[model samples]
Target: MHIKVKFLAYFRDLFQSREKIIALPEGARLRQLLGSLCDSAERHKAVFGKEESLSPHIVIMKNGVPVQNSGGLDAALENGDVIAIFPFIGGG
Candidate 1:
């Protein structure tokens, strides 16, 4: 299955692109997609914490809804799904 991932804010600079099309096997989950994207130690650390779970600073949305509302990293992904990645931002 192929999914589109959109990188925003700091992720854009880290990935060097605004978006990308990634190919994964059928039945892949969000965890697999994130592993594929974090191709390096630095990238991995940026996205995942020391325990190998998603960093609290990051936010992921699948098909316009926050992944947390679904199953988070265990969320099942489908072909043509649109995933957006960005850091959580705060304002005064």
Candidate 2:
């Protein structure tokens, strides 16, 4: 499946590319996309942070709302889904 992915904040800086069309397997989730992105980029370390650890504050939205646990990135993705990857914001 193909989807539109937008990186924000640190992730965007790491990617060096604001947006791109990524191709994934039939079923792909937010988490899986992160993994793939990291794998495909040299600066992935800066975007994903600690190895094997998903940033707790990282926010991933599908269409418009938060991904329901994103099924841990194993979520099924459909064609043309706009994935907005944003950093968790704090107002304290």
Candidate 3:
């Protein structure tokens, strides 16, 4: 399966691209896709916390819907699915 990942805001610089297409095995879950994206230790630490959970500072969406609404890291992924990642923005 192929997933289209979009990096927004500072994530574009962190990932070194605005977007990327990742190929994964059939039935891959969101967690696997996230693991693939973190190709280095620094990248891994940036996206995941000590417990391997997504950092609270980041937000992820699948096909325009927040991942949390779909099932989070365990969310099932299908071919052609689009995933968008961005830092959680806050304002006063």
Please provide TM-scores, in order, for all candidate models, with all chains considered together: 0.94, 0.73, 0.92
The clash tally of candidate 1 reads 0
Give the better candidate number (1 or 2) by TM-score: 1
lDDT of 3 by residue, 1-72 (tens): 899999999888889999999999999999999998999987888789769888888899999998876788
As a TM-score, model 3 comes out at 0.92
For 1-92, candidate 2 gives per-residue lDDT tens digits of 89999888877776767898999887666667777777664545444556655556677788876774556455668889988777788786
Question: Least accurate stretch of 10 residues (summed lDDT) in model 2?
Answer: 40-49
Clashing residue pairs found in predicted model 3: none
Which is the better candidate, 2 or 3, if ranked by TM-score? 3
Best by lDDT: 1
Assess candidate 1 and give its lDDT. Answer: 0.93
lDDT of each prediction vs. the true structure? 0.93, 0.72, 0.91
Candidate 1 off by > 4 Å: none
